[model samples]
Target: MPEAPPLATEHLTRVVDGQTLVADVSIEVRAEEVFVVFGPSGSGKSSLLRLLNRLDEPTGGTVYLDGTDYRTIDPRTLRRRVGWVPQRPTLIEGTVAENVAWGPTLRDEPVDEARLHELLDRLGLSGFADRDADRLSGGEAQRVAIARTLFNDPDVVLLDEPASSLDAAAADRVESLLADVMAAYALTAVLVTHDADRARRLGHRGVRLHDGGGVATGSLDALLSG
Candidate 1:
């Protein structure tokens, strides 16, 4: 039998004040696969990513991680296993290594230097351990942010348009970096994006979040044609 997917959602809904940002949306993300969430602006793509990560509470429905209800787990523990990379990453005042080691070190877990080098090399940031994070380009900063999140050793990564703010060259770099990172870690990822082409290119499956309580999900081809 096939292994159960790493993540799935059932009728997830989120409402802020009187506004319902995300309607009932459901999806199943296979283990080590990239699941893309595509939508036009104001379609709640960001909202859905937040709900999946439990960064924002849902008004209704449930989230499952490895067939276990996520709500049953403590929020902090859940977050460590499910890291988030935002549209605009925030870099602390420190060297790249310091930012990457912050999480595990904070948790009192010894940072793995070899593994750190491996990840930095993979992200094209090798020998940049001592580089000031504040001076990195948009793409470089995002890569550092991703490497930092990886220090937490998350099984699933949530990306809310990590490449959206970058220029074409930088965006391509970030996109390639994401693909490499996922492959290296065999991670399951949910990426929210306004670029349908990106969704088709990187996602194993894709979903389009409509304005109301409607969602259209299917293979990448279907998403591109919609």
Candidate 2:
């Protein structure tokens, strides 16, 4: 029998102050694959990511993680299992290690030093553990932010314009880093990006959002070809 997908949504909708941000969007994301969310600004690409992560409440519909309704799960637990990295790197005022270890620390769990180092190394930030986070460049800080999310050992990772804040070179680096990390962890990922080439390179399948509704869903190539 085929295993259930790690994540799925049914008739997901989100409205804010009479504005519909996401409209009845549904998708099943296969395990260990990159599921791209591509669209123009204000199309609810980020809104969908937030809904999946439960950062924002949906006005209607449902989200499932591992065949269980996400709303039934504790928000903190759900967030830990399904990690999130925003469009911008928001490192706390502290060392890189502190930021990376923040997640486990919140739950009174002991930070795994070995795992922390592993994540930093994977993100190409080795030897940066003790470095002050504010001192790092955009690319480096973004890498740290990624490592921070990974430290939680999430089953799925939601990235909202992860590289949008970086320059061309830095964006490429972040993209490469994400691909490598996803492979290393065998993670299920949902990435929101405006770059069509990026969607093709990283996504096996995807959905394009328009006016908070899903306009297309299929193999990335076909979705982006138009």
Please report the candidate that would top lDDT against the real structure.
Answer: 2
Q: Mark the 10 consecutive residues where model 1 has the least summed lDDT.
A: 206-215
Candidates' C-alpha lDDT? 0.87, 0.92
lDDT of 1 by residue, 163-207 (tens): 999999999988987788788789888888889778876789878
lDDT of 2 by residue, 1-226 (tens): 7777899999999988999999999999999999999999988999999999788999999999998999999998999999999988889999999999998787788988998999898899989999999999999999999998988888899998899999999999999988898888888899999899899888889999999999999899888986
Model 2 segments beyond 4 Å from truth? none
TM-score computed on alpha carbons, candidate 2: 0.97
* Per-model root-mean-square deviation over C-alphas: 1.4, 1.1
Compare the candidates by TM-score and give the number of the best one: 2
- TM, every model: 0.96, 0.97
**Model 1 misses residue 171 by how many Å?**
0.6
